[model samples]
Target: MINSNSRSVAALVALLVATAMPAFAQPPASPAVPAAAVTSDAGVSGTAGSSRDAARARRKANRQLVKRVAAVLARTRGLDSSRILIRAADGTVTLSGTVPDNMQIPLAVNAAQQVAGVTVLRNQLRIGMRME
Candidate 1:
């Protein structure tokens, strides 16, 4: 049996390491979590039999990237208010669904292009398709 003092110290060290490791704390989140997992009402269409918790976390991270892309487009190109939808898979952002106009599409693509952690931009956007 170990001494109580030494055991406590070991536990404390473990906690410190866990907390200090930002990479461990912020692993890749889900692809459907929405702008800020804690806030966005976005839902996941994850693969069957997948862990809900893991999927949600993954989506949350993707949503954050989507949010940044949207913000960048909105500020730089004035196009975030459109119907363009964005999703991320391991830093590759795919813009899909629909948008307001042809101009908005490229603007959105370029916006996603500028964001950090974005490896590529896949435009699945159908120009002029209503997103109702």
Candidate 2:
């Protein structure tokens, strides 16, 4: 009689486990992302691409301005551009690096200011040896 009771309890426990197995195997429902959220994400990606393109164009323009300024400085009388560095933004120019003579500092500033695209000039030139 005790053996039969033990067998019945074991069967009941097995049944409960068998019923619970399917619930554990199936995945729970996941909330779907909103359509507007997906659209905004795509828009943001496009904006980022356009922003990068704009930044690249600006850098190219700045480089062109620097080259123009450098050429002008090279053509100027008694100004050595070998040790001078030129950087340009929208319309602002920064002249850095070394010049052999103090007089050349003003010469560089004047030449850079005359460039068509240069609306502002920052003279950071120092009288020193060539910087490698």
Candidate 3:
């Protein structure tokens, strides 16, 4: 009976140690990622930078087109270029605001279309014909 009680106590102690070992153990370290692997072939950062650059270039080109179209309209005879408003986006030009006469609407649209880099032209000009 004495020998059996000693064995039972030893087994209980072993069981307690087994359960406590994990609480004292250190966590496993995470694997490190290589720099080359992280940046391999058009990674997220690289692609985003390139896309931003492309967007900037497109915006610059559109601004240039707006200037060119505005210059053409300014040079056109019998058209009040000051009253005409020009906006360009993605090579598309929008001509808006009041023109002195109805004939100037087509003139302005044609002038904008003749300019290079104009993919689309939207004419929103209204004639403010004077009664006087």
| Steric clash pairs (candidate 1) | 29-57, 29-58, 29-59, 30-57, 30-58, 30-59, 31-59, 32-59, 33-59
Worst 10-residue stretch by lDDT in candidate 2?
A: 26-35
Candidate 1 vs candidate 2, TM-score winner: 2
Give the local distance difference test score of model 1: 0.66
Task: State the lDDT at 19 in candidate 3.
Answer: 45
Alpha carbon deviation, residue 65, candidate 3 (Å) = 0.5
lDDT of 3 by residue, 1-132 (tens): 999999988987785575446435623322344464444354577865676687679778878888899999999887887777787887778787777788888888888899988889988677663323
Query: Model 1: C-alpha RMSD to truth?
Result: 20.1
lDDT for predicted candidate 2 compared with the true structure:
0.78
| lDDT (10s digit) by residue, model 2, range 1-132 | 999999988987785576446446643322344554334476587866676687789889988998999999999999998878777878888787778889899998888888998998988677764423
Summing lDDT over every window of 10 consecutive residues in candidate 3, give the lowest-scoring window. 26-35
- Which stretches in model 3 have alpha-carbon errors above 4 Å? 1-42, 129-132
lDDT of 1 by residue, 74-124 (tens): 686457446566668768887765565777777777767989979988877
For each candidate, what is the lDDT? 0.66, 0.78, 0.75
lDDT for 95 in candidate 3 is 83
- RMSD of every candidate to native, in Å, equals 20.1, 29.1, 31.0
Candidate 2 similarity to native, TM-score: 0.65
